[model samples]
Target: MDIKKITLFGRKDVKVYSDRPKNIQSILSNHLENLKDKEAIVTEEKTLTYLELDYYSSSIAAYLQKKCDVKKGDRIATIIGNRYHFPLLVFACAKLGAIMVPMNVKLSAEEMEYIINHSKIKVLVSEEKFISKVEDIRRRSTHVIPEEKNVFVIDGKNTFNKLIEPDYPLDSVTVDELDPAYILYTSGTTGRPKGAVITHINVIHSLINYQKIFQTHEDLKTLIAVPMFHVTGLVAQLLHLIYVGGTVYSMERYQNKKYIEYILKYKINFLFNVPTIFIMMSTEEEFKNSHFDFVKKVAFGGSPIYQQTFQMLKESFPNAELHNAYGATETTSPATLMPIKYPKSKVNSVGKPVPVADIKVVKENGEECRVNEIGELFIKGPMVIKEYWNNPEANEKNFTDGYWHSGDIGFMDEDGFVYVRDRKKDMINRGGEKIFSIEVEDVLKSHELITEAAVIGVPDEIYGERVKAFVVGRKLSESSIQKIKEHCQRHLAKYKIPEFFEVVDQLPRNASGKILKNKLKEIGRK
Candidate 1:
């Protein structure tokens, strides 16, 4: 591997992977011819070999091309869950140079409609469970009307099966490396979600970054334990493994017992998920007894890990390398990954920037922060998405000089390791004294009585905002709250201690396993 400078998105001297596949279609084409009959996807219902994946995806592509007139630059949307069809649609659109839009299945009809119309989708792929929502979208709006033929429903009448019957055949369509491949929407917890346009070049570089860090092999096997719509599942689990010519077992929905069973049944070696999922898996009955050392890699992100879950992972996978990868939909998947050979003292840090990634911390005055100084983190690389789809104002505000403002309050240590403290909006201001919620939450989680904790800023007349913490614990008494405050007082500064503590069963989370701070703020107001 060589480091070379190339021009990209009007940015000269951009570092990129020296030698790689031209496009995602080319990457799979190499495997399609060589790894034919090799298992590509194994679902609960069936398994698909590489050759079958190619033929079926090609058949669907041909149908869309010949019947729906879907050509290069077209947008095809999937409102389905984790299935072999999602992967099929990924390849089919890649080969045709059309964009695949994966929507959150849990979204309401109105939310789904916003994405569908905003992306100007030409075809919509969904399942029976969500067909009513799709129909509702059709009934409510006049933005885009999909033809009866263009709507490919997977469950009701087996439209996907008939479309992939091998009768429809397609010729190769010319696709460039930088052509858009997918439009993934952000989790709009506070506002409307924006579609991030990802190109083949961005995806290829991200896959290579994972390869560089994890040293991925062709024989590695992984399971999609998270939502296929999110970055962790879509980019990290599905696409990365596909790029390595590895096997992907589709888990339609995440269940703790099922995750353990698949780990044993499939001999799954690679794992990637959000920290919350791992936290729950630590409590599963099988998790304690089944000390299977087969899993070779375990990676997590989307939230900070508590002490218990981190220790359980270390004890369970003694032979595996654990990583805390941090990235957003805009950065493909991982902008930073915990290096395998890192100091145990810096476990809280999220490791250095990926080889191609450039990260900087800037203050409100637009000046770079010194080592160990907190500021907003900005990431720029070929892996970063060029812009938000059809949102010029968002593009202007979020991107600058090819860098995407991450909106994370963090600091890079003198050793180059990056530590994310909190989201800028989530930082509490107590009478002009800045308070990072993680500081208080970290101390609260360290208590033996608490299992999980989330901190937020509450409105107060005296101080603009006050610190509030929501913790999950067993039978929290009145005295328990006082003891928790005493524990925080010992470890945290006076202003950093939470002013209020509320015990709850669990914190609110999005489909991707990220804590919904906005939801927590609503709870604080009430």
Candidate 2:
């Protein structure tokens, strides 16, 4: 449990602060008391100090307790986005010991209803844009609302601000570190979204992991372009900034040009997002002309980074350190991180295990794999969630002994750097030879005419499955396809080379920018 045992490359023996706040409320209170006047949150609309954030959240908690009868362990579902009100509601629920369920704003009415009813959410809050979807769900959802007042909108007449009691005193609610704080739903590509129950201790430990990995200091300013519903935005960026008493500038949504504008406007020092955002930014003309001198560190995750994009980022931000972080929603945010001073030799690796977590690659027989051998990755630590919400089958299947069986296929080098290959189900088998789709996609991305690439296995009568690549780049021509095939043949083995090539304007992605292979399979069928 001693986090200081994990050493970095440059700093051999790094000491991480072990003492942490018991719950989210305590973390917020500490910042409020010590950094009251410091700028806590910034948006295009307004700015809030720590003192104001505490007061607003406390007042909202008091109102929810008195009016809606919200109590400890009650579920409050929010369908809001990256606005200041989103965090206000999150902190309010944390203060009252209620579990916050941040639903994805892009989900359909049926999808929203499934999560709402399954979580048994007592209160529902949504933005105006999504109010119609909430109404649709309320008409058919199994979870009944006692009254219309239980539902609050962010911009409509029944807004969250109207419920705020400015002078009302919030009753103190006792919260344990082990208590459930929030339940974040997975992308649910395979089936219905399973909610991952994250505890207060898990979040605090994750904050410590980020702090040690990023070497956080005071006055650190970050621009949050990712959605708040994601662990990367909530735990890694927003909450971590608050834990360090730093400033955060949140965007309602991500636009490549606007993201650059905010970076300069806020003088952002830290940047964290998925690889797609960075790739889009690097391709923009404004990004090439803008100055990124204020950016000190750039961290990305949720998917593998192509070598071409990595080099683009390195050249774009010469002063900043580019880090490729690796984790899932089950592990809070990050389990392994490539350090700022990482070597070029291990550039493809996701670095070593973080200070608070441990990782191992294991075979189907449950035996640990040797160096450079591909196997399923398993993560263990205080930061790892113990189970899914109300999903006993998933808990039984995914959790073994104290480790969560991450469904990712990867390997570790002799130097302890982890290299993620592909998802367990994403691996393609042609005849007896196994092929990782990511390897082919990475090679395709390196091609001069290719902007993005996705490789999937299509059903083949002889080989069971054959490699097919979907690319977004120059117009497809006989010569262009031949050129790409030639490039793949040079880099990959004969069997690993894609047998079919399809040119598309774009690849389908989930909210986190991960390529949806399921959708690609549907395309293959057509």
Candidate 3:
């Protein structure tokens, strides 16, 4: 079967180029030269043409070069959200070979300070909403810069508009393919967040993989509701859209009902979000009435999607194809993607390994596991990051044998489909029986009243660790807990059943929609 033809909407015989250009500017130049008048990006009330995007990016690049003395490989941090200026800011950094460090909006001042200081960012481009956080950190953090003047707010009193005038452009600086393009910080749920140093070649390979696996079209209008700080938002959403001359519509944040409204309003061809957002939207009564007539495809990534939630999304948006993806910040976004066509079997699988990325299930000792055997998932290819920024320890532990250890437990079927089990660190051990949190969570979610659920191991003097679940809802009762356990018993081993259940109003989650298992565990312990 032709993967390109199956995934992409256009020509099947188009040559797939594995060799990436030296710099990201080359990609921008090519797209600008080819699709000058095309709409490259669209925000709430702004539309940016390809030519305009090129000029603005070049202008920002010039400003960085002259004002901040930023050179190739210099780290510039951005504490912003999804908007028309987001992609332009990223391209500006890329054009000058400056690494763009994206700050997570969901993180507190301390988390932001850690990333900014650890990455050694010289200039910070932030939005007004996060200015206080930056200021707070600047005042107290000894590691970060003490002066607030070092930070430049986007569309604020001290904005990039002053640095770059209208129609101002500069000579494009050339960059090597291996030069670092961005420093994307992954949530340090296990430890301090590590900044993955993604290169131009890494992004180029990721774009190619998205085009091949999703069959994106040049005229496609992608809805980029995901935050640009994420690998999915950067490589898969914005960069890919620009590379293919497609249009991207940005959102400040993901709101289930509002997201559906945006889709209907924009008639978006491509929709990118996480499973949680989709799950909420799929169940929303308002979404059932909305017309998704123009939405050709919906792509979800960042975490595992429950099977029932997938089915619910499919039922709600029957006109559009629902696609699942798997990857991390170190993988330059999407390493694997489910095809647009609905899978006839194992609907929860994250599809197959994308064209440029190779994935394998390996044992703890680094040996490849057989099909259907659960093990650590390792991804290898051009899309994988070369190293972590100033993180020697992380580089040693995560990158080995030319594969990035995903720290995710999963398996591959005979047909090459990947099934994510859970995070290696999130696994709960009660006595000798191993319980995957996702298994318990999925079972709990199957209930009609439960909105969200997370299973974590809490301290137990007798069992080493005891299985405990935190649910999100007030409708839950003792019968509901028993039903959840009974459901888990049917699908999982006896050891996997939760010994304790606590029904809360909600489960603590990070900004990217990932359940904060450590936070849940802390609560359980308390």
Q: For each candidate, C-alpha RMSD in Å?
A: 1.3, 3.8, 4.7
Model 1, position 489: C-alpha lDDT score: 82
Which of the two, 2 or 3, has more TM-score? 2
Q: Provide the overall lDDT of each model, using Cα atoms, as 2-decimal numbers.
A: 0.87, 0.85, 0.78
Per-residue lDDT over 282-304 for candidate 3, one digit per residue giving the tens place of the 0 to 100 score:
66777877766667777887777
> Given candidate 2, what's the lDDT at residue 365?
97
For lDDT, the strongest prediction is 1
Task: Kindly report which residue stretches of model 3 are placed more than 4 angstroms away from their true locations once superposed.
Answer: 1-16, 19-22, 141-143, 146-150, 166-169, 341-343, 477-479, 486-492
> TM-score for each prediction?
0.98, 0.95, 0.91
lDDT of 2: 0.85
Report how far off residue 43 is in candidate 1 (Å).
1.3
lDDT of 3: 0.78
Error in Å for residue 334 of model 2? 0.7
In candidate 1, position 394 carries an lDDT of 95
Tens-digit lDDT track of model 2 for 1-526: 3544433212223333367779987878887667999988897777889998888888989988888899999999999888988878878999999999999899999888888888888888889999888778668853554357788888767567766757567899999987999999997888988999998878888888788778886668998888989999999899999988899899998888898888887788899988999988877788898878777888989988889888988888878888889988898988898876777999888878887677889998999999999899998777788589999999889877668899999999988899999999989999979899989999999898888999999999999999999988855555699999999889999999998998898889877677888999999978
